[model samples]
Target: MTEHAATGPVTRSMAVPLGAFAAGAVVAVLLGVFGRVHDPTLSGTTDLGFRTVIEMKVVVSTVIGVLVVLQLVGGLWLYGVLGRRVPSWLGTAHRISGAVALLLTVFVGYSCLWALGLEVGTLHNGEKVPVRAVVHGVLGCAVFGAVVVKLVAVRSRRAPGWFLPVAGGMLFTLLMVVVLTSAAWYVATDGWPSRAGY
Candidate 1:
């Protein structure tokens, strides 16, 4: 009976969610570990016209945070958490916004990884990165991991109905934390750059 217990319907049904959790954990750990070990590029040029790469990352992170809020609302609407009748257009909009938010986050993540690695005690603008930035780096990696869970759960027919909503909420929460720790904190403390009114 104990042997079959592992193969019970509830357990079988939970495999996808379990797989998702493993995938997220692996991705986050790999990225964070790699960042800590890699030799950062340390220099680059951007024609996108931001006053600094830091500013660019901050702005994009903020935008990603805003889009995450929309995602939470859309997910609720689609799941009938908000009410019964979801608009047909909501799904498409949700997909588009989610894609954009993901791309933006990837851009920021790539920039951070390539230019600065995990920061830790690394000097930036003549000072070591604060603890919040280190927290942001780790959490930022976790956001992409959660995104992996959400994406797989969203696409997998075998995934339990609750998986999608839970994955989405997790992603939303991680992103909000990542944004708060980095972009929002920067804004609250330092404000915008003199030339980066954007």
Candidate 2:
């Protein structure tokens, strides 16, 4: 009876986000599998004119990092963490930043996943890649999944008040991991303007 009491109330509020997140998780899992299964030797480059796809990705990811920082601060402000009164312009700015960041993230992911997928061992793209590349791939996939969860949580009327904040924070954390692994690592090892000619 106690177990039933705990689990039986699977209300619409709970079910919608749960189901939405599960679907998003599936998308992430499929992306990870694609990264591993795809031919790493196959090469493609972005027309954006960076000498390599990785450079383009690093540039995009860097922008995304800045955008997420904005999102975090704005989120805190909106939640009254920074102040009692929220700015009228802040909510719109937050939404815009989030949307742009998500789009840029997708662009980077698509470019990387298509051109290189996941690299293993030494000398994949004329450069040595470490295990972190694989880890980055996994985290990259999770970001998209988290994005879906956040989007659903945002739109769900029945979701608890705390649910959206928790979801947004989690998504931001996941994205930072992706940025650190790919963008920060690339800049540190290769320099700010990547030798690949960003």
Candidate 3:
């Protein structure tokens, strides 16, 4: 009689997650360190007014946040995590959404890092910085890092079956954190573009 062999060691299964986590952490640390060293003034100028660019970023981020949600839903559907049969076309939709999301993220990240640097708070002659701003910057870096991890997990042939789902979840959560701290905060404080006080 023939017997079936079990899967390999638990450590082998964990390799992808551990590697992705390490890579993401490295990316976050690098971005934070870069922001600390770089001067905001040295950033590239946009043809649009400063406030206009900021407002544009907010809009883009909101749209990206929506896309992230859709991506998450698509992922869930594809994995049968919702206990529903995934349509064949759903895979294509998910890929398209993921591509668009990544593109949007790249644009926003460039604009943020180039135009604003890591703006924690306004430094007075003697005053305490706002904790929110600091948290926002940290989360922004983490968003990028999570994206990197997701991309790596998706493309890696050796990655475990669970890697993509976990990476996608992390990416979605980080994106939401970034949106809440930056775009949502902006909308709350400034309202929409036309009515924004700048």
Candidate 4:
């Protein structure tokens, strides 16, 4: 009975986000596999340049980009000021939400590395170079570390109060910094000024 009670809420809380994420994963896999079989490499550069590739990159990037922004910003606010005072359910939700965000953060980092050659030693000369890859990489690492720290805090209930909150703030700052830098890099390299060959 006690075991059932404990497991029940955990399952309930995780259901919605886990379900949506799973469905999205299935769709992405289907598209990637089916789309690649016919096209092999999808779109690449042309004399007209990489309009399709760039647009596809931006659409997915922008969606996950906004989500990362929201999680970092909102997570910080929740953990820093209100964490001490919030009811237990809210705190549990905060941790659950953060776990999901960390998963997204890792996925985005790896996807960018594959899709845009953002990882070190991955870029071919002609690929679009993200000016902020190093910064984003560092933040991605930090996000991973913070997730560990958060988990430790949850497990060790006597963990220092400051550990979790500081981690939250760090995540918030790192994400925003990466997003702004990436945006700047995109504009600088791909904007009309460069496109016009000026």
Residues 171-198 of candidate 3 have per-residue lDDT tens digits of 8988888888778999899886542454
As for candidate 4, its clashing pairs are: none
**lDDT of predicted model 1:** 0.85
* Candidate 2 global CA lDDT score: 0.83
CA lDDT of 134 in candidate 1? 88
Candidate 4 local lDDT, 37-141, one digit each (tens): 333333333222334444433433455456666555455556564355545565566556556666655555444433443243334575753546655654544
For residues 52-140, write the lDDT of model 1, one tens digit per residue: 78877888888999999999899889878898799889999999999999998888888888777887885757887788988888888
lDDT of 3 at 3: 32
Segments in model 3 whose C-alpha atoms lie over 4 Å from true places: 1-13, 42-51, 121-127, 195-198
Q: Over 4 Å off in model 1, which ranges?
A: 1-12, 42-47, 121-129, 194-198
Alpha carbon lDDT of each predicted model: 0.85, 0.83, 0.80, 0.49
Q: How many collisions per candidate?
A: 0, 0, 0, 0
RMSD of 4: 10.4
The positional error of residue 53 in candidate 3, measured at the CA in angstroms, is 1.9
User: All candidates' TM-scores?
Assistant: 0.85, 0.83, 0.82, 0.47
RMSD of each: 5.8, 6.4, 4.5, 10.4
